[model samples]
Target: MTTMTFTRKDPPQWLLDFWKEIDDKTFGKGFDCFAHDAVCNLGVADWHGRDAIRENLRQFIDRGFTAHHDVVEYWDGGSLKVFHGKVRMTFDDPALPVVRPAMAHFFYMDEKDPAKVRRWLGSVGPIEF
Candidate 1:
């Protein structure tokens, strides 16, 4: 089993900038902002790498769905951080007309001296979505 620890510190400015970029890409740019090696679990699918993440985002975009996330809570360690928030997806599905809401957990690991998110783990539900 892998043990994880959480710490509270100020996140680097670049990380925050990355989040903003992701938001813009998903909502405004109609593209994906996650890295190629990003791991995503959103109760529907489990994806790894930037390619896989991008494909998943592409699928969403193809379906005319917009993914949005609000960071309700965050904990930052020097090399690691955890973010918790609500994720909502709004799509043009006539059957499912409302935004789907779920709890989101994001784990980020900083790589090298630049402190970029080398690895990201996200869980959205009991299943890998």
Candidate 2:
């Protein structure tokens, strides 16, 4: 299997560490990245508050899929950060095909707590080049 290459462009150390937690399957540690009242919008559903978001993420992680994200680029706009990447998801079910989709994360940090994400909007799918 070919290794994924992360081409992150000077993203914050905290953000980098958060992604590490995701790839490492350490959701408990990664939960620190979100504020207590943070909101996550995944297009189809809106997960409000930290506990809800954490539960949503936990469900996804606990499912039979392992995900690896390869960050291709990053844009820092003060409190708003944008990350463009590709995720490779391998499912435990052999009948299911592996999925590699382009993903984008738009994170708005809490003004009072800069280290925490107040709002996160994410999209994943094939994009035209």
| Alpha-carbon RMSD, each predicted model | 4.7, 8.0
Query: For candidate 2, lDDT tens digit of each residue in 17-104?
Result: 7677767787666678889999999757599997898778768767888888887889877678899888888888889888889888
The per-model lDDT (C-alpha) reads 0.55, 0.80
Q: Top lDDT: which candidate number?
A: 2
**TM-score of the candidate numbered 1?**
0.59
List ranges where model 1 is wrong by over 4 Å: 1-48, 125-129
Global Cα lDDT for candidate 2: 0.80
- Flag regions of model 2 displaced more than 4 Å: 1-8, 126-129
Q: What value of lDDT does candidate 1 attain over all alpha carbons?
A: 0.55
- C-alpha TM-scores of all predictions: 0.59, 0.82
